[model samples]
Target chain A: MAEEECLTELELAIQVLVFNFYKYVPRRSLVRNKISKSSLRKMLQTEFPHMLTDTGNRKAADKLIQNLDANHDGRISFDEYWTLIGGITSPIANLIRQQEQQNSD
Target chain B: MAEEECLTELELAIQVLVFNFYKYVPRRSLVRNKISKSSLRKMLQTEFPHMLTDTGNRKAADKLIQNLDANHDGRISFDEYWTLIGGITSPIANLIRQQEQQNSD
Candidate 1:
């Protein structure tokens, strides 16, 4: 492939990664083995109450759920969960999201 | 397919998203048109210095660069760049990462 083509392909590869990160992960309804908020909260409340209080873990979880629950159905599907909290909360992650959005348009 | 298989597949899908987020983005060599530190700093200094100070943007950028520069080669390959700030800094995104690493091992 030409140099430009390689770059384009890499760009595409990057996009695939980004789309998966932004679109797929956030939207996932659940991860079977992964810990859930209620479980984590319970664990934190007892085992690491300091962490919960210091990090504002409860509030953070709320924010995470709000961001992921795109439809506001009171519960997040796994995909919506990932998008909001999956690859989010960082500038570069947001960059991937912003780029994918731009590309789709 | 059995219900178990579907759940496993979804778990795998989630892993792929996480592995890609953690393994790829923070490790990126570069994004062609994305803003750079110096440029961002300059922009912030001029146009949005207030925001820079307000959110500790400069510090956040510093933290971002450090996290992404995995190889410490002085400049980020976009891949390395993405991983650090790409899909990190969130509990859910990090969960993807933690799972993928666990699965791989």
Candidate 2:
């Protein structure tokens, strides 16, 4: 059986979210386990195409990086990256649920 | 076109994660937008089958709730829920990447 066949929905979802982080960090930078601002901007554009359409823009992406680069290291660590994802997902989650309710009504 | 078709991989993954939280919260408690300890325990056992096998046990799941109930509300808010998901995913992410490297070698 395929790996996904054995996984639950949430398990697979977590895997997708986690693996997406690695897609941006280069192999050489695996030791640091962080993505640069440019890589993050690219990730926002490609991976988060719909959810973060505004931040997918170059200037807005830069602003996001500045706000989320908690340690001022000029790079985004896994925790910081998770924080960014959570921050973005929170409001969108509310909106999505509201739309669902409206659709069902 | 279907809604899922329009979403990027990351967007769908986020939706799965976010909506899972609501599955545990009853409609009556919708205003609070939080889930109780028992609900969280059920969520962990059902949704996070692979990622949190140990916590699938009732005792371990309760321990997890205690730790993550940041406001001591005996309930888990969306932020707390996200934190728990992130905390669990972070270490598993490292392990998964390492196993991938080994498999590719």
Per residue, candidate 1 scores C-alpha lDDT tens digits across A1-105 of 123233332233333333344332222333432334444234324432332343344576556555544444444333443343333323334444455556656
Sorted into a CAPRI-style docking class, model 2 comes out as: medium
Tell me candidate 1's fraction of native contacts, as a decimal between 0 and 1.
0.00
Model 2: DockQ score: 0.51
For model 2, the superposed segments whose C-alpha errors exceed 4 Å read: A1-3, A54-64, A100-105, B54-63, B103-105
TM-score on alpha carbons, each prediction: 0.23, 0.83
Give the alpha carbon lDDT tens digit for every residue of B47-88 in model 2.
Answer: 777666532344444565778765677878788889887877
DockQ of each: 0.03, 0.51
Best of the candidates, TM-score: 2
What's the alpha carbon RMSD for model 2?
3.6
Itemize residue pairs with steric clashes in candidate 2.
none
| Residue range B41-104, candidate 1, lDDT tens digits | 3432443233334333456656655554444444433334334333322333444455565675
lDDT of 1 at B44: 28
- Predicted complex 1: DockQ: 0.03
